[model samples]
Target: MKKDGQDMRQEGALKAADLEDAVRRADPDRALCARFLPASVRPDVEVLLAFHTELTRALAPARSAAIAGPMAGLIRLQWWRDVLEGARTPDHELAPPLLLALERGVLCRETLLRILAAREAELDPQPEVSAWRKMMLDGAGGLQRAVGEALGVRDAGVLARLEACGAAYGAGAMLRHWPRLQQSGRYLFPGDEAGLRGEGNAFLSACDTASLPSSARLAALPAILAERDLKRGSTQAGLPRGLGDRLAVMHAGWKATRVFQRSGAAAS
Candidate 1:
């Protein structure tokens, strides 16, 4: 290869490695993170993995903060965005992972912007479900389009596929959290365990059995649909071919909370 080509390849590889590492950090489930094997992904696909990690982490700080206090999650999101856009420089080494991932032609500039916008949406004191849905979709919807281009697709249709994923994933979130919303009078994001299950189980049932093929497992998983909500299974376990492992982790975390309650964590 020419020197220029070699340099480009090296840069791509570094970004890919950084993204994969970042995503693994974000997943919060060791078993699920391991599913992305060493050989299954191309270097360019790290964009999504990194995205998965960052977005998940952005929503989780307050809960993980281990102190009962005001919501600090959005503060953390702004803190990182400030660092990434050079508004502030973080002291931690994880500071530049997303910025480094940006150089690989993995996404347009708006990807991170949209993610921050979504975080802001999440930070609202109160949010309507419809509005929150739009915010969530915006963050991830463009990624497939961006990745299609980077992966050499001349005209790969991204909107339709990502819309499908967003709808399914979003429905799963609402269905999973319907009961919680009814009780708390607040719209919740991921990483809130008790809050999610307190919502109506009926809505989840409706969402699960809804006519959409993408989310048919909202109630009865049977392995295919269980893939999105649970992280323990392998590809051989028969989930559909296209779902992101992060969705699977989300599903698993919800279910684990149920199990923990049954075992008396919440009650205790």
Candidate 2:
């Protein structure tokens, strides 16, 4: 029994290291921002982000494949749905860590399903801007809420701000990845570029930080950065590389910390 226990510990550690590596490779920006989190909270947040990265990456082959095509993507997503619903056991490397987090309540089944649904929608032949917008909002809101839960934030106002921030981030992502999305043959914004930009700007304008809880500020930093990128007309393939991106992330983190501190002081 002792030998078995020791083996389980070894396996668990390996799984965690793999998940961390996946997150670092798939979403380095989030990985960088995660450095600001307390050690206890970082693992859960990383797992959530890793799960998200896995889903996003799954869409790539389908986007690029002309033979097996989007059907292949749909099947991959369905497998995730099956794993989440417990209809099938997880065998994929990424699935085990996410499954563990789900079991531990670090992640929610409903939110996972919603995110999967958004991903599945990308396979649609005539994807609408409205549908994309709704998916973005739902996906971002669910992620922010999950992060807030991991951070022990329970304030309704703070949670609401996190959700708004998420939506804005989603909008900014759409703009930033416009070229790639177009190349992928996906119509995330359809034909209404102006309308899409208008909605993204509106979401950014509505993200109020003054009331956000201190513990939840790190979870809100992506949204803050997204808003800044949108304002600066940044529409690149990925988060820009080099000194500028590093400085932007650092600046956003600093601003969020200040807001959180002020909120704490007022409550005291």
Candidate 3:
């Protein structure tokens, strides 16, 4: 049976909604921060984040299976690269929205490639501390840049700040998830636990979220919880599970909203 144009649009909408829910379940911190964005771009933010989550999940088989797992994961990552480069097309749900994002300039090919490269490196044997640190920073920071671009932020300074914010958050996340990663047979920084913490702290110290332009606040908002999680030490990998964690994100998002409003008024 042939599907009409309206039917196709409806199907796309449903898939997008399902993808958003999946992202909420898979990456809750970023999902919560996404709520603070303007309605006009919230979907874009959510979808881009889902892309990040998908990239992470692509490594699951590699982490689990014994022999063929890593190779399988590498092939999956390569498939995404082919799709992004227009070398292939599959009937995947996320591909449509992702390609649309790339076409609309909301995402850049280079940033996405960097993310893929980082993931590719993850499949390799454990890296040196410096190499691991670079991979984490580039992967996380690249996602931040993509998010900021979706928010219409083009300022070099703001993008740099976003990168720093994401790097801090990434380091803290690695610490929090160290146990889980160890269980999965993944050693990011090897035995240098203290060094990893120092890297996160240094990145956190360099981040000035208060000075960020209002437009980029949501993109950098995860750093709020990153600071708290880092202070709490690396006992668990999951997001902080309490009303307090929710309130902290809410408070920072609220303040950023106020700034956004003031900036909007000034521009008008």
- Supply every candidate's count of residue pairs whose N, Cα or C atoms clash at under 3 angstroms: 12, 0, 0
Clashes of 3: 0
TM-score to true structure, per model: 0.48, 0.80, 0.89
lDDT of 3 at 142: 76
Sorted on lDDT, highest at the top, how do the candidates line up? Answer: 3, 2, 1
Q: What residue pairs are clashing in model 2?
A: none
Q: Which stretches of candidate 1 lie over 4 Å from their true place?
A: 1-51, 61-71, 90-92, 125-127, 140-157, 173-268
Per-residue lDDT tens digits for candidate 1, residues 15-59, read 444444554444323324233312323343454545444544555
State which candidate, 1 or 3, has the greater lDDT: 3
On the 0 to 100 scale, the lDDT of residue 238 in model 1 is: 28
Highest-lDDT candidate: 3
lDDT of 3 at 144: 81
TM-score of 1: 0.48
Model 2 / residue 72 / CA error / Å: 1.1
Angstrom error of the Cα, residue 118, model 1: value is 0.9
lDDT of 2 by residue, 56-163 (tens): 766777778879788878887888899999899877655676787778876677767877787877676455666766676667766776777676777777766776
Pull out the clashing pairs in model 3: none
lDDT of 1 at 155: 33
Winner on TM-score between 1 and 3 is: 3
Off by over 4 Å in 3: 1-14, 236-240
